[model samples]
Structure formats: structure tokens, C-alpha cells
Target: MLAVHFDKPGGPENLYLKEVPKPSPREGEVLLKVAASALNRADLLQRQGQYDAPPGASSILGLEASGYVAELGPGCQGHWKPGDSAMALLPGGGQAQYVTVPEGLLMPIPVGLTLTQAAAIPEAWLTAFQLLHFSGNVQAGDSVLIHAGSSGVGTAAIQLTRMAGAIPLVTAGSQHKLQMAEKLGAAAGFNYKEDDFSEATLKFTRGAGVNLILDCIGGSYWEKNVNCLALDGHWVLYGLMGGATISGPLLWKLLFKRGSLITTLLRPRDKKYKQMLVKAFTEQVLPHFSTEDPQRLLPVLDRVYPITEIQEAHVYMETNRNVGKIVLNLSQ
Candidate 1:
């Protein structure tokens, strides 16, 4: 099997394709012939040596993949059979011709979606669903703000929030991205690079502020995010793209508003926890994709690159120019 490997943790230049032993399924697992894999910010961090794969997991760069089940190991017989189309959220090792995954992590490809589109769903959609419903506790008619609105998770969050009957507001760096967010069901969007998003959000919600906020930029947007929330609002932090330290006085405002600040990460969680999330998303969200209306829960893909152009893909992602997921077609 050919897999993406790095000589050292540094730059995309270090990534190379090499022949490696194909992985075999263990108990409760299945071996998949990977058709496509998607890119994420975590992949960039891992390549730069800022993040490490969880203990006992593969060191490969990918976090999610879509493919066909080639074999099922012991204890996994009834769950899925060989030749079944599936997608999975993996801890790592998705950037290869094949990967072994826990059967519980595999999701049947939604009806009418191609393998490449399925490949783009797991990580972004699952993360968005978990953050909005579980952590943020978003309810119908609630006002929610999503930062980085044109990103993979952002695009998913916009659609999910709207579907849940919440008012979805967003922030992006460009007018084009803002438009894209609105088209995906965001009530409104702000150009974060050129506008005071906090003020804009307040105006959009008529000064009541939003009930929840999904944030990826950390310190730089911390104070603003706190100010943009309604009383008893929830602010969920999933990334620290703009540094991690907060330097201003924010405790008083939070106390006055009875706000809650929560931080979370998905990659390092135990298998049991991930299985719980997968089950919840599979039951609640997957059905939307399988319905007769195939467009209902489609993933937004920015671009698809062949496996051989892995370096170029990384370069494109690092530029922060994409409005949605960037996929790698393994079979290409």
C-alpha cells in the first residue's frame, strides 16, 4: 500500500508517498480501501511538529476517510460486509490506500453522494454537530454566532444551526466567504478582517446578543466574543488559531451576563467517547443526508487534489484561502 510519509515534522516539502505494509483489521474493526481523505488544520499542525498523534494511533496525517469495506475482523461480522461503501472518523492513518478502523466509527455513505463527497463529511460535520447541540446546547429560535464561517466546520455549522431552527450568524475574512455563508443558511455574516464583528453581531440580533458562539480564533477574539453573547450565553472554543492567552479584563462582563466559557478538542478523546458522538450524529444527522432530497446535508468541498499533489494541497490550506474542505482523492 502507498501512504503519505514525512522524513521529519517540518513542512509539506517533507511529505512523500512510499510503499508501506497494508494495515489489517483487529477485533471490532474493518480494513477499508481508502478512496479519498480530507484535510484539516490539525494536519497542518502535525506537519509543523506542533501536534502529535494520540498514543497507540497511526502517525499518518489524515483524520477522516471514505472508502469501501474490504474485510471485517472478528466481532465485526454483522455490522458491515466486504464491498460496503463507508466513511469513517479516524484518529490517524487515513492518508493511505487502506486504513483499519473501529467498526463503530464507520458510517454508511449517504445515498446519492460520491466517495469524494463522503470523504469530506466525518470530521467537519461531526465536530460541528457536537459543538452546536451537545456543548453549546443550541435550541430553536436561539441566536448563534459562528466564526470562520467559510471553513469546513463553519460551513457545516451554518447548515446545522439553521436546521435546528436557530438564527445562524457568521464571520469570515472576505465578502465572498460571507456570501457563501449566507447562501448556506447563515442569517448574516461579517467580514471579520474589515469590521468589528462584535458590534455587527449585536446589531444583527438587535442588541440582545447571541445565545451561543462557536469560536476558533482564541485570544484575539476573546473579549469581543464575550461581549457579543446574550445573558447566560455559551461560548465554545474549539481552536486557538490567534494565540491562547487573554490579556484584557473580561471576568466582570462574563459575571454580569452569567456566561459560560467552554473549551474542547476532538482528536485526543478515548474511543468510547468518540463512539458516543458517532452514534448520536449517525442517528440524528445522517438521516438528513440519506433522504430523497440529496442536497439536504451535503458537505461543502472547496477543492479536490490527487494523492500525488499532497504538498500542493497543504500549501493551499496554509494560505487560509479555502472556503470549505479540501479533499485528496486517493484513487486518482
Candidate 2:
């Protein structure tokens, strides 16, 4: 097996494809032959030593992958065998050609999707789904705001928000990104650089504010998110791309608005919690895939770089030059 490993944490330059021992499945686990893996901001943090794998997780740095089952461990059940196409959200180790995963975390590839595209869904879509449905407690006709509307998570957020019958308001850096979000079901888009999102969100809601907010960029958005929430609304914080800090006065003001601040980290979340999320995604959302083909099941990637070109992929993501997921194709 080959994997992207780093001896010293730094930038993309630190990533190198190296031969490593193939991981074998343990009890209740399964081994996968990785076809594709996608990059995330967390991968960047891991590369720079800012993030560490969860306790007992692999030191290898990939969070999601699409692959085929190569081996199954003892105590696993259900209808599965060698060559079953599947996608999974892993805490790490997805960068390798062969990695072991807990059977509970893997899901059969949704109908109408290729293994590569399926790789793009597990982490981003799961995160978006959890944020909008589980944390936000969205209801039909409710209003929601999502930041980073062109990100992988952002793209998934737009689609899930629409599916739940909620109006999705998005903030992206460019009009092209905003347009992309609109095509994906976002009802409104804002240029975060040019507009004050908090003011815009309130105005868009006719001064009532939104019922929920899915915030990936923290820092200033934290304060503005508080200002943009309707009374008793929930704000789900999933990432801090900008910064991570919460002010006392902000908490006081949120108390006034009856806003509840909820934060979650997928990797560190309890296994039972993640299992619940995986179950929810499988039962409630996976069944909705269009019967026609996979394009509707998952968005197309803007770029696919070989595992050897991981550096370039990281650079592209840092520049935010790509829309949708940027995946590493092991076949290349």
C-alpha cells in the first residue's frame, strides 16, 4: 500500500507518497481498496500539525474515501462482499491504498453515483446534513443561512437545505460561486466581502432574522451569526476557517435573542453519536437519491489530481480556486 505521509508538519510540500503496510481489518472492521479521497480544510490543519487524529485513530491523514471492500473482519454482517462499492467517513488513514474501517461507518454507494463521486459525499454531505437537520432542527418553510456557499460542505448544504423545504441563504466570495450555489438550490446569495451578512440576513428575513445558521467560518461570523438569528433560533458551529473565539457580550446578546449556540467536531464526537448520524444519513437521506443517475446524487468535482499531486491539490484548495470537491484519484 502507498500513502501520503509527513515526517514534519508544514504545508503541502510536506506531503509525500510512500509505501506503507496495508492495514488489516480488526474485529467488526473491514478493509477497503481506496479509489478516491477528497481534501478538506482539516487535512490542511493536519498537515501543519495543528490537528491531531482522534485517540486510537490512524496517523494517516484522510477523512473520507470511496472504495471497494477487499476484506471483512469477524463479527461483521449484512449483505456485503469483496468488490462492493462503498463510501465512508474515517477519522484518518483514507490516503492509503488500503485502509481498515469500522463496518458501522461505511455505507453502500448510493444509487446513481460512482465510487469516486461517492468519496466526495461521506464527510461533506454528512457534515452538512447533520448541521442542517440534527443541529439546526430545520422545518419546512423555515429560513437558514450557510457560509462558504461554494465549498464542498457548502454545496451539500445548499442541496440539503432545499430538500428540507428551508430557504437557503448563502455567502460566497465571488458571484460565480454564488451562481453555482443558486443552481444547486440556494434561494439567495451574498458576497461576503461586499455586504454585511448579518444586516443582509435580517433584511432578507424582513427583520425577523433566520431560523437557523450553519456557520463554518468562525471569528467575526460568530458575532454576526448571533445578530442574524431569529428568537429561539439555533446556530450550529462546525468549523473556524477564519478564527475561533466567543465573546461574553456576544453570549449575553444571544441570550437576549434566545439563541442557542451548538458546536460539534465530527472526528471527536462519540462513536455512538457518529453511529446515530450515520444511521440518520442512511435511513432519511440516502433513500432520496434520484433513480436516474449519480449526477443528482452527488456534485461533480472541479478537479481530480493524482495522489502524487497532492501538493497541487492543497495549493488549489488554499486559493479557493475550485468549486465542489477536489479529489485524489489513486488510479492516476
Candidate 3:
């Protein structure tokens, strides 16, 4: 099996395909023959030695994959069999041709979706779902602000927010990205580079502020986030793209608004918690992706690259030029 490997923690140029032993299924797990996988910001961080894989997780780089069931481990329920098409939410190791996954974390590929498309679903969609429903406790009539609105998780968040009957406001750096977000159900879009998104958000809500915020850019946006958070609003922090150092009265301002600052990371969570989330997401959201639905959910894709071009894929993601998920076609 060939997997993406890095000799040292550094840039995308360090990434290369190396022959590695294929992983086998463990108890209650399934061996998947991966067809496609997706790239994420975490992958870039891990490559740069900024983030480490959780204890007992694969050291390899992908967090999600779409594949066919190859084998099932003992103690696994009879939910899947060899050759079943499935996509998995992984802690790591989806970049290779073969990887093992806990049976409970596997989801059936939505009807009418290709393997490359399904590959984009697990991590981004699940993260957005968890952020909006679980962490943010979003409610109908609520106004939610999603940063990086055209990003994989951000795009998913916009749609999910609308589904919950909440208004979704987004901030993107470019006009094209803002347009993409609007098409995906964002009620309003803000250009963070040209305008203060907090003020734009407040203006969009008629000076009432947003009821919830999905913040991926931490530190730099801390003050802005609080400024536009409604009273008792929830602010879910899942990433720190803009740096992590805070030098001011962050606590005082949040306290003033009675805001709740909740931080979460799906990759490092316990398996039981992931299983529960997967089950809930499968029941509540997976069906909408099927073609049978008139307004089916969409898994936005920006680019697809062959697994052999892992370095180029990473470079592309680093450019911050993508509007949606960047997929790696492992089958190629």
C-alpha cells in the first residue's frame, strides 16, 4: 500500500508517496479498500508538526474516506459485508489504499453520489453538523454567523443552518466565495478583507447580533465575534487559522455579553462520542443527500487530484484558493 508520508514536519514539498504496510481491521472494525479521500487544514497542520494525531490513531494523514468493505472484524454487528459501498469518518489513515475503521463510524454512500463526492462528506459535513446542532445548540429563527463561508465545513454549515430554520450569515475574503456561500443558503455574506464582518453581521440582523457563531479563525476574530454575538449567544471555536495568541480582555468582553465560548475538535474525541454523533447524523441528515429528496443536500467539491499527487493537493489547499472540499482520488 502506498501512503502519503513526510520525512520531516514542514511544507507540502515534503509529502511523498511511500510504500507502507496495509492496515487490517480490528475487533468491531471494518477493513476498507479506499477509493477516495479528502484533504483538510488539519492535514497541513499535522505535516508542519503543529498538530499531532490522537493516541492510538493512525499516523497517516486523512480524516475521511469513501471505499468498499474488504473485511469485517470479529464482534462487529452484521451491518456491513464485503463489497458494501461505504464512507467513513476516520481519526486518521484514509490516505492509503487500505485502512481500518470502526463499524459504527461507517455510513452508506448517499444514493446517486460517486466515490469522490462521498469522500468529501464525512469530516466536513459531520463537523458542521456537530457544531451547529450539538455545540451551538442552534434553534429555529436564530441567526448564525459562519466564518470561511465557502470552505468545506463552512459550506456545509450554511446549508445545515438553513435546514434548522435559522438564518446563516457568512464571511469570506473574495466576492466569488461569497457568491458561492449565498448559493448554498447563506442569508447574507460579508467580505472580511474589505469590511468588518462583525459590523456587517450586526447590520444584517438589524443591530440585534447573531444568536450563534461558527468561528474557525480564532484569536484574530475574538473581539469581532463577541461584538456581533447576541445576548447569551453560543460561539463554537473549531480552528485557529488566524493564530492563537490573545492579548486582551477576551474574558471580560465575552462575560459582558453573557456569551458561551465552546471549543471542540472531532478528530480527538473518544470513539464512543464519535459513534453517538455518527448515529445521530445518519438518522437526522444522511437521507437528505439522496436523490429522492427534491432539495437534496450537496457535498461541495472544489478539486479532485490523484493520490500520487499528494504534494500538489496539499499545495493547492495551502493556497486558500478552493471554495469547497479538495478530494484525493485514491482509486487512480
Candidate 4:
């Protein structure tokens, strides 16, 4: 099997395909014949020696993939069989041709979606679902501000927020990205590079402030996030795209608003938790993607590159040129 490899983590230039041993399924696991994998910011970080894979996880770059079940290991429940089409949220190794996954983490591909589209789900959708529901505790009628509004998780969050009857606000760097976000169901979108998003959010809500904030930018947006948070709002921090250090009275401002600061990382979470999240998402959200409803969920895809172009894909993502996911076709 060929897997994406890097000798010393540094840049996309270091990424290459090497003939590595195919992974085998362990107890309660399934060996998937991967067809496609999707890119994420975490992949770039891991490549740059910033993020490490979870303990005992595969060191390969991908965090999500779509494939067919090739084999099932012992103690696996009878829920899946060989040749079943599935997609999964992986800790790592999805970029490889063959990767093992816990059977519990596998989801049947939604009807009418190709393997390429399903490949874009798992990590992005699951993370968005987790942030909006599990971590943020979003409620109907709530106003939620999602940063990086055109991102994979951001697009997913917009739709999910609308599904929950919440008002979704977003911040992107360009007018085109902002328009894309609004088309996906955001009540309003702001240009973070040109406008004061916090002020815009406050104005959009008529100065009422947002009930929840999905913040990927850390210290750089702390004051602004606190400014737009409603009384008792939830601020969920899942990424640090900006710097991590704060120079202001973050605690003081948040305290004044009675805001709750919550931090979460899905990749490092226990298997049981991921299984629970997958089950909930499958039951509650998966069907929407297959429905005829005009507003049914969709996985936004920016581009599909052959696995051989992994370096180029990374370069594209690093430039922040994608409005959604950048997929790697493993079947090619």
C-alpha cells in the first residue's frame, strides 16, 4: 500500500508517497479500501511539526475518508459487512490506500452521494456538529457567530445552525466567501479583514449580542468575541489559527458577560465519545443529505485532486484559496 509520508515534518515539499505496509483490522475494527480523503488545517499543522497524532494513532495526514469495507475484525458487531460503502472520522491514516477504523466510527454513505462527496464529511461535519450541539449547546432562536465562515466546518455549521432554528452569523476574509456563507444559510456575513465583525454582529442582532460563538481564531479575536457575546453566552474554542497568547483582560470581560469559555478537540477525544457523536449525527443529521428538501444538507467541495498531487493540495490549502474541502482521490 502507498501512504503519504514525511521524513522530518516541515513543509508540503516533504510530503511524498512511500510503499508502506497495508494496515490490518484489529478487534472491533474494519479494514477499509479507501477511495478518497479530505484535507484539514490539522494536516498542515501536523506537517509543520505543530500537531502530533493522538497516542497509538496512525501518523499519516488525513483525518477523514470514504471507502469500502474490505474486512472486519473479531468482536465487530454484525452491523457492517464486506464491500459495504462507508465513510469515517479517523484519528489519522485516511490518506493511505488501506486504513483500519473502529467499526463504531463508520457511517454508511448517504444516498445519492458519491465517494468523493462522502469523503468530505466525517471530520468537518462531525466537528461542526460537536461544536454547535455538544460543546456550545446551541438553542433554537439563538444567534451563533461562526468564524472562518467559508471553511469546511464553517459551511457545515451554517447549515446545522439553520436546521436547529438558530440564526447563523459568519466572518470571512473576502466578499465572495461572505456571499458563499450567506447562500449556505447564514443570516449575515462580515468581512473580518475589512470590517469589525464583532460590531457588525452586534448590529445584526440589534445590539443584543450572539448567544454562542464558534471561534477558531484565538487571542487575536478575544476582545471582539467577548464584546459580541450575549449574557451567559458560550464561547467554544477549537482552534488557534491566530496566535494563542492574550495581552488583555480576557477573563475580566468574559466574567462581566457571565460567558462560559469552553475548549474542545475532537481528534484526541476517547473512542466512546466519538462513537456517541457519530451515532447521534447519523441518526439526527445524515438523512437530511439524502432528502428532497430544498434546504437539505450538502458537503461543500472546493477541489478534488489525485493523491499524487498531495503537495499541491497542501499548497492550495495553505493559500486559503478553498471555500470548502480539498479532497484527494485515493482510487486514482
Candidate 5:
């Protein structure tokens, strides 16, 4: 099987196309003929050796893929067979022609979506859904502020927030991205490069602040989030794109104001929590992507590169030049 592999992670240049041995189904896993895989910020961190795959997990460089079932391992049952079209969010190993995932992790793809487009769903959509509903506790009529609104996660957040009857406020560096968010149901957009999102957020909420904030910019946007939240609002952080330290007694201030803060990672979640997330996502949201109804949920794909061009894909992401998701099309 031809797959992208890296010996020692550093830059995108480290990725190369090589014919590795094909994997066989394990006791509880099933093999998939991979059709496509999508990029994520976590992939960038992994390529830098800052992140490590789990114990016994694949050292591959992808998180989400769409594919068809090749064969099921023993003890697996209930409606799956060879050539069944599916998509999965695996522990790793998405950048390949074939990979195995636990049977329960796979979800049937909607009929209208190509394998290339279906590859974009799993990680971004799951992250957005978990933050807004599971952790942030967002509800209908609530106001939520999301950072990096042009990002893949941002694109998903805007759409999901609107679905729950919440108004989404977004921030990005460019007007083009802001317009993209607007088209996806963001009620308010801010330019963090030139505008003060804290002030703008206050104005948008009539000085009441927002009920929840989903942030990844960390130190660069942390203090601003503190200034922009409604009383008792939930503030969640999942990444630190900026510096990670604080110089003052910020915890005491937050305690005084009765605000809540949480930082979470998806990889460390218990199996049940992850399964719950995947199940809920499949039930409440995944059905919207059927061929009959035409409810497409993919973010704008700025570029799609073959598995051999992994190096170039990394360069594009590192340059911060893309507006939405950039994917690796393995199906072709």
C-alpha cells in the first residue's frame, strides 16, 4: 500500500510517499480502503514532533478519512461488509490507501458527498459539537463568541451554533474570511488584526457579554475573552496558538466574577465519552448530509493535494494563507 510516512517529524518536507505494508484487520478493527483525508491543526503539531501518537497507535499523520470497508475483523457484526462506504475519525493512520478503525468508530457517508468532501467532516465537526453543546453548555437563544472563525473548526462552529438557535460572533484577520463566516450564519464578525473584539462583542450583546466563548488563541486572546464574557459565562480553550504563560493573578479575578474556564483535549477522553460524542453527532447532525435533502456541511476547501504532496500542504497551512479547510485527497 502506498502511504505518506515521516521518520522524524520536523517540517512538511519530512513527509514522503512510499509503499508500506498493508495492514490487516485486528480482533476488533476493520480495514478500510481510504478515499480521502483532511488536514487539521493537530496534524501540524504532530509533524513538528510536539505531539505523539498514543501507545500502539499508528505513527501516521492524519486524523480523519473517508473510505469503504474492505473486511471486518472477527467478533464484529451488525450491518457492515466489503465495499460499504464509510468515514471514520481514527486514533491515527488516515494518510494512507488503507487503515483500520474500531467498528463502532465508522459512520456511513451521505449519498451525495464525494469521498474527497466527506473527508472534511469528522474532526472539525466533532470538535465544534463538543465545545458548543457538551462542554460549553450552549442552548437556544444563547450568544456565543468563536475565535479563528475562518478556520475549519470556526466554519463548523458557526453552522452548529446557528442550528441551535444561538447567535454566533466570529473573529478573523481578513474581511474575506469574515464574509465567509457571515455566509455560514455568523451573526457578527470581527477583525482581530484591526478591531477590538471585546468591545465589538459587548456591543453585539448589548453590553451583557456572551454566554459562551470557544477560543484557541490562548494568551493573545485570553485577557480579551475575560473582558467580553457575560457574567457566569463559560470560556473554553482547546489550543494555545500564542504564548502559554500568565504574569498576574488572573485566577482570583475570574473566581471573584464567577466565570468558568476549561481547557480540554479530545485524545485523552475516556472511550465512553468519545463514543457518546460520535453517537450524538451521528444522530443529531450527521443525518443532515443526505443526498436526498442536499444539506451539505463541508467548509470551503481552499486546496486539495494528493498524498505525495504532503510537504506542500504543510507549507500552505504554515503560511496562514488559507481561508477554510485544506484537505489531502487520497481517493484519486
Candidate 6:
């Protein structure tokens, strides 16, 4: 099995393809012959030694993949079989040609989507679903603000927010990215590098502020995010790309508005919790992908790179040049 490995994490240069033993399925798991894998910020952080895979998880870089079920482990019968086309949300080890995943994390490739496209779905879509529906409890007609709106999770969040009947307000660094967000169903988009996103959000919602905010930029956008929330609004934090330390007064505003600040990390969660999320998303959102509608939900792919070009893919991602997911075609 050829897998991406690193000796000591520092940069993308550390990553190299090496021949390693293929992983086998354990109880309640399935072995997938990986067809494709997607890149995420977490993968970059892991490569640089900033993030570590959870205990007992594979040290491989990828978090999600699309593949065919090569074999099923004991206690994993009746749901899947050999040769089944599936995508999975993995804790780690997706960068390899073969990955063992829990059965619950596997989703059949939806109709109208190729395996390569499905490869981009699991991590971004599931994270967006969890943030908007499970954590934020966003309801129809709610105004939700999403920062980094052109990111993988950001693009998914925009589509999911619209699908749930909420108005999505997005913030991106460029006009082109903002336009992409709007094309994906965001009600309004703000260029955060040039404009105050908080003020723009408030104006978009007619000075009422938004019902929820999904933010990845941490300290730099903290105060503004707090100010952009409506009374009893929910603010969900999933990443801290802009540093973690926050200063300034916030307790008073939080108290005055009865706001809730929630933070989550998906990789460290137990299997049962991930199982629940997978089930919920499959039932609630997967149907939309196959539905006969003009606004069908789908994974947005920014670019595809062969496994040999993984380093270049990382470089492109670091430049923030992608409007959606950057995928690696492992089978290429």
C-alpha cells in the first residue's frame, strides 16, 4: 500500500509516499480501497505538528475519502458489501490506498455524483451540518453569518444554510470568492479584507443582527462576531486560523444579548457521536442530493491533484486559492 508519510512534521516537503502495510478492517469496520481523498486545514496543521490524530487513530494525513468497500469486518454485515461505492469520514489514514473505517461513517455515493466528487463531501458537509443544525440549532428564516465563506466547510455551510431555509450571510477575502458564495445561495456576501463584516451583516439583516454565526477566524474576528449576533444568538467556533487568544470586554455583551458561545472539534469525538451525526446527515440531507430540484445540494470541488502532486496541492491550499475542496485522486 502506498501511503503519504512524514518523519517529523514541519512543512509539506516532509510528506512522502511510502509503501506501507495495508490496514485491515476490525470489528464493525470496513476496509476501503481508497479512490480519492480531500484536503483540509487540519491536514496541514497535522503536517506541521500542530494537530495530532486522536489516540489509536492512524497517523496518516487525510480525514475523509471516497472508495469502494473491499471487505467488511465482523459485525458489519447487512449494510454494505464488497465493491460497494462509498465515502467515509475517517479520523485519519485516508491518504493511503487502503483505509479501515467504521461502518457507520460510510455513506453510499449519492445519485448524480461521481466517486471523485463524493470524495469531497464527508468532512466539509458533515462539519457544516453539525455546526448549523446540531450545535447552532439554526431554524428556518434565521439569518446566519458564515466567515471564510469560500472555504470547503464554508461552501458547504452556505448551501446547507439555504437548504434549511435560512438566509446565509458570508464573509470572504476577495470579491470573486464572495460572488461564488452568492452563487451557492448566500443571501449576501462581504469582503472582509476590505469591509467590516459585522457592520455589513447587520445592514444585510436590517440592523437586527443574525441568529447564528459560524466562524473559523478566532481572535481577530471574536469581538466583531459577538457584535453581529442577535439577541439569544448562537455563535459556533470550529477553527482558530487567526490565533486563539482573545482580549477585550465580552461578558457584558454576552449577558445583555443572552448569547451562547460554543466550540467544537470533530476529529477527537468518540465513534458513537460520529455515528449519530452520520446517520442524521444521511437521513436529512443526503436525499437532497438525489432529489429532482433546481437547487440540488452537491459538493463543490476547487481542484483535483494526483497523489504524486500532494505537495503542490498543499501549497495551493496554503495560498487560500481554493473556493471549495482540493481533492487528491489516489487512484491516478
Question: What's the lDDT for candidate 5?
Answer: 0.85
Using lDDT as the measure, the top candidate is 4
The TM-scores, one per candidate, come to 0.98, 0.96, 0.99, 0.99, 0.96, 0.98
Candidate 3 residue runs with Cα over 4 Å from true position: none
Q: Write the per-residue lDDT of candidate 6 for residues 86-153, one digit (tens) a residue.
A: 99999999999999999999998888888889999999999999999999999999999999899999
lDDT of 4 at 258: 98
Q: Which digits, one per residue and each the tens of the lDDT, describe model 1 over residues 273-330?
A: 8999999999988988865864487799999999999999999999999999999999
* lDDT of predicted model 1: 0.93
Task: Give the Cα lDDT of each candidate.
Answer: 0.93, 0.86, 0.95, 0.96, 0.85, 0.93
Give, for candidate 1, the lowest lDDT window spanning 10 residues: 289-298
Error of 2 at 143 (Å): 0.5
Tell me the spans in candidate 4 whose CA falls farther than 4 Å from its real position: none
> Candidate 5 at 25: error in angstroms?
1.7
Q: Give lDDT tens digits, candidate 5, residues 1-332.
A: 98888788688878898889999988778899998999888888988988887777787878889999999998787568998999888778899999988787788887678887778888888889999988899999999999999898899999889888899999998999999899888998999889999999999898999999999888877778888888899998988897688767678767865899988877656556777888999999887777565545655677898877888999999987787788898876
- TM-score of decoy 2: 0.96
In TM-score terms, candidate 6 sits at 0.98
lDDT of 2 by residue, 91-128 (tens): 99998898888888898887777777888888899999
> Scored by Cα lDDT, where does model 2 land?
0.86
- Tell how far residue 220 is off in model 1, in angstroms: 0.6
TM-score of 5: 0.96
- Candidate 4 CA-lDDT value: 0.96
Better of 1 and 5 by TM-score: 1
- Give the Cα error of residue 86 in candidate 2, in Å: 0.8
Worst 10 residues of 6 by lDDT: 286-295
Model 4 lDDT per residue over 1-332, tens place: 99999999898999999999998899999999999999999999999999999999999989999999999999998999999999999999999999999999999998889999999999999999999999999999999999999999999999999999999999999999999999999999999999999999989999989999999998899999999999999999999998899998999999999999999999999999999999999999999999575668999999999999999999999999799999999996
